[model samples]
Target: MHDYTIRAFVQGNAEFVGFDKYAEVFGSTTFPTALLNTAVFTLVSILFQYAAGLALAVFFRSGFRLSGVLRAMFLVPWLLPLIVSASTWAWMLSSENGIVNSVLGAFGVPQINWLTSPDTALLSVIVANIWLGIPFNLVILYSGLQNIPGELAEAASLDGAGAWKQFWSITFPLLRPVSAITLLLGLIYTLKVVDVIWVMTTGGPGNSTTTLAIWSYREAFGTGQPDFSPAAAVGNVLILIALVFGFLHLQLQHRQEGS
Candidate 1:
């Protein structure tokens, strides 16, 4: 086993050649593009998912009829296998036979090559990610909303505060911990997203939707020759980013608690 490990490292090092591989990656334009795409995709999807989840949570928290059933239905997307969801969306977005384009065409709107067009490819992945994540955010925020004492909102409303004011001043402040935790967790998960983008775009139509995780996979295993060192570096970078976000979340919670 030890000999095999050493042999693997030796073969991998032959290609890496010290920091040469690192320099090549940094100098490559595709590297920066992948980084930017991943950042945008993660940020936009998380923001939309969180906001939509919060709205849904608040709406369902109002105790409407079939609220429990509706909540379970919303969660169905998250519960489904991610690959299955991604493939379904991919088929739906296919320019020729996709239901999305077909419906749009029927309405006199132009059909978009969602997964094939460079401009639309990354955004398409983000849409899939948002759909996959909404349930997670909704469930977490809804539980948090349930734990918030009703008396707090009632007292705020009695003081001549309107619904919006009560929510902004009382409910939101109490949900801060829940929000912070969800945001950080979502960030971490988004950073590592691969299956949806991989199954949908394969980082193609000119490498427009390539993310770091996908890039790393391509480098280490997808290519003709395996490059483990750069893959390790990419994984390290992702871990560092996740750690920083987690630390910031904890700090935010500490400050909120102290105040």
Candidate 2:
């Protein structure tokens, strides 16, 4: 890739720099923190999102009264625009007069800063992201649940299997294919998350929440003086990460089928 900059773009005077930009990005001080944040954010969000979604899907599958209405309500977070959701979270987590703090205050807890403190900024965004992703997992996993034959559960119950045993012995094993795909898709989505985080904390309180995606976006557009080449390099690294996971998924699938 070429060493492109905002001024060079306007003047058509870009110069080829080969891997210099990549070298610079890898050597930068922020790269390690960004990489670690990205990893923690992605892994934590996916794990909780999938667990909560699967639990909700199973709950709704029980055919309780008003279940449809409750499930529909769960989709509200997913239906709302990212900016709206992020802004709502930001408002709710405000240290002063926020509903969260107000409720905590009633219980004799301190008013803690959610976004302003480095200690909790990353956690704040992760919580918001997990909330946003649960609906997606719920929908997909719920559909997968439907494909499982009710007879299997019926037979397991008749054989004296408890709910937990039925779930572990029959439901979970049958849902493996669906779970794999859901996790893979969630990983890809979480990897490029910027809008929600940007709207909430702008990767701040001092790069505490700055993932690789944020780093790339900040370099390219967050500032008035854009550094295009390094942004491109970081973007490419993200792509490589996604592709590596995708290929690993394929390999696992192939191995499963072979076995």
Candidate 3:
């Protein structure tokens, strides 16, 4: 990673002329691609994580044999430092000597170049992120499930409501508030994620995994001449993205509260 002391003023012909780093950042080819990648990575990771977590929550709604023990075990991923998880996943997804490939080989599947290839690098990181995020979903949704009055399910059962009917008419409706909170928080957290992508791919393989967060980091820190102005511009764009999600989250929250 490149590092440089902050310069209060930019000095170059651009200063004398009419060159604008702000315009350059937006008009550049890189920004659009990074934005697109960030959106895809965040949406896909959160969607799958929520699905998997909610499933786990529902499964563990009622305490079972060793359920607490197992739930604690599930928390391992979320408890781990992002750096550790990212590094571990990097090792696991390595093309040749990776555990994932080895397991697939055992099943006679072809070895997939997970991190090295442009096509699969983003996907590999998303899968790791989903794993990292699932425990948060499970814990929050499980608490939400517990807060739900048991009588609701009892009444539904007495009314001969099937499992599906109970979930849709009862469980899912109640989960909406918690679900909204989870997704919004997930969005905020996922939007600025830089560690995993950086550690795994360094936004390489021809920039296939260069999300906005990574883009911002690279602009400020990766290049030889660290241009803080364009990097600041990119940071503002990230803030705008966050604001959009923040608005949606507030809307969801207000509607939930009003209901």
Candidate 4:
């Protein structure tokens, strides 16, 4: 990469800097915080999203009355545009008069700042991201469940297996391939998330919510004095992270197949 400055880039005189920009990114104080935030944001969002989505998928597997309608409703969050969803979350989590705090107020709880406060800002964004991710997980996992033979569960039921036991021994094991892919895709998606957090916190009250993606965007465009090289380095770091996980998934899948 090159040491790209706005003026130099315009004049086509940007100087090649090799990996200097990467060194700068690694050495910067914000790098540690951004890396940690990115990990927390990605991991937490995936865990909860998968759990909630799988639960909903299993619930809907019963094919209850109006199940189709209910399942479709869950897809609303996923179908909504990112900006719209983020803006809606921002409004709902507004500290002064948010609907969340309003409900808390009725229960004798004080109004807590959701987005503005550094302490809760990361949490707020994570919650919003998890909500956005659930529908995708539900759809995928539900399809996976369908591919699994119902006869397996039926046999387990005949053997006196409880619902929980059937799920753990039969349903879950059969769903591993699907679950792995779902989690991998979720990891990739969550790793590079920008719009939702950007709309809600813009990296925050004090960098508490700044992930690698936000840091990269901030360096390149969030401020008037754009520093393009370091931003590119940060973006590359995210790509490397995603690739590492992608490779790991492949390796594990290969081992599973070999076995």
Q: Tens-digit lDDT track for model 2 on 1-259?
A: 7889878899998998888899999999999999999999999999999999999999999889999899889999999999999999999999996798899899999889989999999999999999999999999999999999999999999999999999999999999988998999999999999999999999998999999999999999999998889899999999999999989789878976886
TM-score of each: 0.90, 0.95, 0.90, 0.96
lDDT tens per residue, model 3, 1-259: 1112365343322333134556787798997888889989999999998999999999898779999999989999998899999999999999899999999999999999999999999999999999999999999999999989999999999999988899999999988899989998998999999999999999978889999888889878887977666676778888998999899989988997897
Residue range 1-259, candidate 1, lDDT tens digits? 0111235676753332566556666677888888998899999999999999999999999888999998999989998998999999999999999999999999998989999999999999999999999999999999999999999888887798998888898889889889988998999899999888888998887889988888877767766777666666666677788899888988987987797
What's the true lDDT of residue 206 in model 2?
Answer: 92
Q: In candidate 2, which residue ranges exceed 4 Å CA deviation? A: 249-259
| Cα lDDT, model 2, residue 145 | 97
Q: Write the per-residue lDDT of candidate 4 for residues 1-259, one digit (tens) a residue.
A: 8989999989998999888888888999999999999999999999999999999999999799999999999999999999999999999999886899998999999989999999999999999999999999999999999998899999999999999999999999989988998999999999999999999999988899999999999999999999889999999999899999999789878976896
For residue 1, give model 2's deviation from the true position in Å. Answer: 2.7
Greater-lDDT candidate between 1 and 2 = 2
Report how far residue 143 has shifted in candidate 1, in Å.
1.0
Model 2 residue 156 distance off true place after TM-score fit, in angstroms: 0.7
Candidates 1 and 3, the one with greater TM-score: 3
Question: How badly does each model clash, as a count of residue pairs?
Answer: 0, 0, 0, 0
TM-score, cand. 2: 0.95
Model 1 CA lDDT for position 93: 96
